[model samples]
Target chain A: MPTDFELTIRPRKGWQAVDFTEAYLYRELFAFLVWRDVKIRYRQTLLGGLWAILQPFIAMLIFSFIFNRLAHVQSDGPPYKLFAYAGLAPWTFFSTSVTQSSNSLLANHQLVSKVYFPRIFIPLGAIGALLLDLLLSLGLFFAMMLYYRWPATVALLWLPLFILVAVLATAGTGLTLSALNVSFRDVKYVVPFLVQMGLFVTPVIYPARYVPARWQVLLGLNPMAGVVIGFRHALLGTPASWAVMGVSIGVSVALFVFGLLIFRRMENRFADII
Target chain B: MKPILEIRELSKQYKLGWQRLRKAQNVRELIADGLTKPLRMLRGNQNHGPAKQEPFTLWALEKVNLDIYEGDIIGIIGRNGAGKSTLLKILSRITSPSNGTVVIRGRLASLLEVGTGFHPELTGKENIFLNGAILGMRRAEIIRRFDEIVAFAEVEKFLDTPVKHYSSGMYVRLAFAVAAHLDPEILVVDEVLAVGDLSFQKKCLGKMGEVSRSGRTVLFVSHNMAAIENLCTRGIVLHQGKLHFDGATKDAIQYYLNSLSTRFGTGHVVDLDGVGDRRSIVAPLLKRLEFFTENEQPLLEGLPTGSKLKIRVHFDLPGPTLSFNVGLGFNNSYGQRVFTAHSMFEPNRSVKESVGPQVFTCEIPSFTLMPGEYSVKVFLELKNREADAIEDAAKISVLESDFYGTGKVPKNGMFVLEHGWYLEQAADAK
Candidate 1:
């Protein structure tokens, strides 16, 4: 004897279609989380928002001095300051989001252990917070363009698509790291070293032209590779590098699908396992 | 009315070691290990067993099927580790079940914990919204009830202050107020209320009563017999992961008491060594207990209003010492400690020379007892020291007298001694 009104919720696998309504309902929490992250990062700091721009600005000066001066690296005829800053902006956002989001579960151990909500929001919140930092750094990127009397192109409007690809790459990796961080804490220790290695490998300080034309497509599979080349072309009024941006968009979307699916599947085990 | 929550068969399992033993040295190793788990699953074993599988899971709640109707204030009483919290966790959606499923109708809220979802850095008002969301409330509803929540929590002056700075009273007040004002279709609360001050506890219990009367369901877990009897209309007692009783509230409380009395005597279980396995072939050991009149009819069995009784113990000690202390402690049926008497505290040193068969008696001359059962605990201590040699507690015996004097039943708490008072206004008037 059963009532006809019983509503049984069927549990699903990771890649299964998600109920966006649930995530949408929790949007306020997500927004608050994003805002909360923004405030905490800037609060009580003497430099305030300048801290955001300075990280990349100082990195550009160091890279320009070391790579452009000592290593005598070529930057496709543009100033080294613009080259390094262009590459550093998206790279900084990607790396910081990974570090923050990977440790997101550990940082919110209390919330993760005790409450139930969309777990993706924690890593996504990191992305939202890092975006503010990226925006602040962008101002410096423009100031550099003006300082060097570099020309701006309409191609800059297309920067948003490159940014989307960068974010997809970050979100894909961030979600994987955040979910895995709950169980295997080793992800935290490995992130810094990987970020360092990524900078050199992605040609952030040097020009991609040095990487030989045939090998560039395979190199762009790094995702950030495409983001760097695209930012260089967009800001310097150069032609698009189809070989690099094409590989970046492809890799980013792939990572996005793969990361999101694995993350959703593993989110169910979080409360119990963590 | 249909049950607001139904749990068919809920189970949760966990694995303990690999996360600890196999440390990941780098991202390559981490990804390699993560990728391997799914690969193993694809090799035939499914990965759907964590919620369903405990490596050696012994059904925390096996085939547990129940229906909780709307507006029914049901008490969940159980022994420790009796699956009480597990059942609530499954119903609360804190965790999903392994084998069976639970269908919850309407919004289900659980006050299973206090300060849940609270950010230490967030202000009290902000945490209210955060806490409300955690309990399944919408943002608009939280905004509508925000003022009432602050008023109920008594934190009006400190709404902007971060909750990490609040005192225990303030923290609990706000935590409980958020849960109280959620006004969900069902509320499942655990035993966190034992921490608050007495008056606030009474206020919380009163609010729970009001919540019940307003046609909502509540599943309450508490060791307070009086509060459970006062608030819940029904009770479900769990014993070792099985349903012991599911009936009227009074009968359920009685069933719990009877079972406890049978197992642990009327007194609470006292362990002198704080060790569970303490058994020895002794001289005069403190073994078991019962309260009896001179005729020994189990003192609470139907005695006169004002009568004397002797509490007897059956025991022997494996080893004997000179003047090892033996005494008695008393607690009300509700498990509150009332009084204690020991040879160590008084001028008198009553020592049993031979330890084989010892009998101790406390004569209650003109015993003034109310109508409820009273539990007496036995203690053997190092006389005058803050240590026990052997102890057994919560042995119950009834005092069936009209000593409460108002003809009302004795409430489950420390007894209020009847002392007649006279106020003669100074023989007035010259």
Candidate 2:
């Protein structure tokens, strides 16, 4: 037999690093899974991709009415509608990615149990699907910026970096939760509550300036806090907070690494447990 | 020739009662359970109670060492829970083995289930790519063979339609077509041909034969004896998590059959649960088989020729009642099926649609089989699908008798047909 490719199988011992090369080899499958998720999300729906825009758009409306109109929450600079939307768009992306990817293994139990691929792709593909929705909601944010006559600024170049931070944070939390969700189904019930509570803890509805100055550092630990503030600074020319961004980026990277470790440790048992 | 795959001391242990024990009522209890896990491990033997006589762990597979060479089509056969699937899973890397190691020298692809990653909402074209990629084909390869796959499945016209709308036949065809096109150095398949229609099954068997002929190694697990005997060059029988026999396909099949008869001893009433040669996707539905005389008494002595015979089959049906058929096949000592009596043959005799344990008795007014040993095969079908089939379920000896109420008897054929010969003169003879 030709010995071009050799594979060794044995009991995995202790903690192992994620097999990035194996995942890379199955990149086509990962891409297909992401495509499938994106296609299935919109297929047969009355409103197709509009659901992406409508999710955050509707949330922004509700938050503006309650938090801005009634409570008179501070926006820091831009109109509360645009400011709230800048935060809501990425928040929607983060929350939905977390929820969907957390359940990805359970939902595709057949795939996980029957086929061999980098199981991490199951959750990562789910996050990849929501990236399109993030883009869609960002389109609505750009339109809102136009309506509010917010001129373009070079700070907009930082938008991708902020988006990368959000992706990292989502991947970190989603991978950890998805892996845990395989063994302990209680993660399913806990995730929604966590995401719901997450919105208040992060600065999705109000500016980080509204919080006490001392606790602002704690708020940056949430990762999405810095993402929301960064989105406003990038899109609406609001003053950027490098310290909070540094802390959030650091937290996001740490979470991502921690999540990968957990995922790699638990992935071997996923097929049996799931 | 050097073997393409080598496995040494492969074993897998599953925690049997852990899922039940892990059923924590709430978060606090779950946390407490986690905290006390190490302590409980330390006190393991002391915690064993009378009610927990069964061990908490099950060894699904023991030290199974195997070496498979290239171009060998090996049929892995055993009863249900015989570690066929566990071995395949370990080879496919779907689950890790608890002990030992396996080394493979070439690319391997395993098809445990067809249409595994197929999304009902995805179009046929989309599913083809998705399923192909899931089966470990590169996108470029799928793109190159896209047309061939579509044509082979005969779904060219509906390639853009969602798979949910495709007929069951169409779906299976498309799925198999994609799988058939996969060209891996080593391929492992389990029971996938059990789906689809008979003709499609034939086509799939043909495809498998072609694949084996092309010199790629194939490992197949199946309950269909004929397919295994026809397609495999070698066979491996796993009995109760250990490698029982491994040799040429013919010897392996004989070994499996012999082992099965001994495992479930011959008797008037045989429990079907332990019967090895069953082809059923569902759980053990046909529970037992009992043989009786004309008057429903258990037959102890050999059945005399021309005497009435009755066979009773006991089965349990779970869930709502559906249309089903039971059949009994009589095969001579040579393994040639002489005749079959199927419930579907007499459609007017509707079966009672009651749930749970039920008995169906079939009676023949005159036993016509020539005095010889014949094996009885029982099968049950639910909605035209093979729910359960057990070959050589029971054996009966037919005693020689005056079948025609004459002194002479025919001894050559398997069956005796009633006939009268009259001396007649043809025109030329007259």
Candidate 3:
């Protein structure tokens, strides 16, 4: 099974260079790492896979009570509980992915120092593991929708697009913070705060409609804002702000590309520094 | 076949010490540094202070060039910090070199350490696939060989159990089995073979032998001289970040040993800091080791073959003093241990703390070594626990001298024994 792969080693190139081909060659490694991450996450726990659903479901309950019951907030859809859970789903996925992926490199520093892989795979695998949790929790989201007598809309076909954008956003930020964590350990302390702060900015507890109309497009630049809004539109059949989604898609793509370049630039020094 | 790997002028420099902090920047400055630097560069207003270079750097490898062909098992031998691992790291692409290039043909995999990506929570079977894929094995390939790998590791019964529960020996075996089964054209192995029991080490060596015989080139780095001699046909010796020798295994080992011995023979008292082979089982108690004449003067140059020689060793004991023995090994220039003498065989000599720094002196009455270059190795053992051992601790050249009254002396053999030969009438041929 010898493919036409010839490895040439030279002095490191400029910061913009990344070796997608080499990463492609180790595609099996990526898959195995992802599998290992997913397996190890739920191993030896009592709740096991159910924790994925329980975490977001419980958070949805608390948020629905606090905002809808106590604060008497006006959510986009009719039932505030359904609206809050829908936004919590993607927001939870993004926050968890960012937090775990940021620490993935430090947790696997032993492997980083001992072996050679793309290094990107560690964080990518972290994201992959959280993605499984997101899917598992989505089942509960649909159950909640059914409980609320929400109609199944044809717009649900576009759900995968919003998920992709969410992944792109998570990966982009994850890779950048993870690479920075290697050199400046302060990134570790910053990640939790970033994730916590991201919740308020992502329009997860409330609808994006609560944000001022003039600031709505600017909120799309947060990437997760657009994803949460898009998820509501697809599932609840709310007319989506196409302009905001467009800005979000563009910002997510840009972040992903730039994150990859920074990750590759910092990669060569990882074995030495980490 | 073309060389499986060609390394040319490969060098790696490592910065040492704590890095100095630069001017603290606010988020505004940080964003400007990342995003707008290119546009600002066009306006030519990018005035900046000269960059402060690192004060010190240690070159781990300097201009090292090596070519490894198919089926070649080259043993890399070096003292600690000799750049053997650095060379392998460069070859494996674990780290990029500071200078030069390496052209590698065919698929290559490196076992810098066994079980590189093994997750403790994963089962043995799961880890086999995970580690295999990490080492570049395809999923189908791992599936095809999964049973073989398990059988080889002798962990078949524990396949479903997490690797964290596996005993260290079982863990190492399972890790090695996955690595050894990788079907790469070139394999780079480090000193991870030092793990496991002796029998398992032999088994791993046998597997490596099979790998090389199957037409794969292997670069093996190890400090075990016997293992190197037994396995590698070619040898490379690295000294202080440079390629010291590259030749036949026999010659390379001899050259490395000679260099160690010569460094020890410089006559000045050797301060025991990073001295001797790190692989020695000794616990490093030697503070100052030296050789002297009977008059306590430092022995320099050559001594007569039949002269009295005295060796003094000074050692510091960090813990409470115990009854210890000072053992010395004398080897001829060919790196063969001619004889070993231990103070345990002698009476009334116990290294005690009351003596301050423990000093032990051994005197040889009429040293019978033949006229040749020789080296000394010293070992300190207390209660049968080896405290320190320095191989090639000192070297002494022996000049020709006549021990017998006869005008002629025999020119062959290592030493002479005092004896009398009586002429007797030979029995009739049967």
- Candidate 1 local lDDT, residue B121: 71
lDDT of 3 by residue, B321-418 (tens): 45667888887753557888899877666545543467788888778888987767788875576656776667778888776758676577779778
Question: Could you tell me the lDDT of residue B155 within candidate 2?
Answer: 98
Per-residue accuracy of model 1 over A39-104 as CA lDDT, tens digit each = 668655798889989998898889889888999987787777888899899889888888889898
Residue-wise C-alpha lDDT for candidate 3, range A1-274, written one tens digit per residue:
3554567899885685677877787888888888888898989999999999999889988988888889887787658877887888898899899989999999999888878888999999999989989998888888878888989799899899999999999999999999998977878799889889988988888777888999988998998888988888888887789899889999999999988999999898888888
Task: Kindly state the number of residue pairs that clash in model 1.
Answer: 19
Interface RMSD of 3: 1.7
CA error at residue B384 for candidate 3, angstroms? 33
lDDT for model 1, on a 0 to 1 scale?
Answer: 0.72
Report the Cα lDDT for residue A158, model 3.
89
lDDT of 1 by residue, B1-430 (tens): 7667776755544333221222456788767766676554344333342221213223456667788878889999865556788778667655666667778776666788778777767789888987887676778889999999999889999998888899989999999999899767778888867767888998898888999899888899887888899999999998756677999999999998777655452232232223232222121246555566645556545445456666555555333445556677665544444566655665565555554545555656545455555555565543232222232244445555556577865554434465787877686657
The CA lDDT at B141 in model 3 is 91
Q: What order do you get sorting by TM-score, best first?
A: 2, 3, 1
Quality of candidate 3 docking, DockQ: 0.47
User: Model 2: runs farther than 4 Å from truth?
Assistant: A1-3, B19-55, B269-296, B299-430
* CA deviation > 4 Å runs, candidate 3: A1-5, B19-54, B265-268, B271-430
The lDDT of each candidate is 0.72, 0.86, 0.82
Best by lDDT: 2
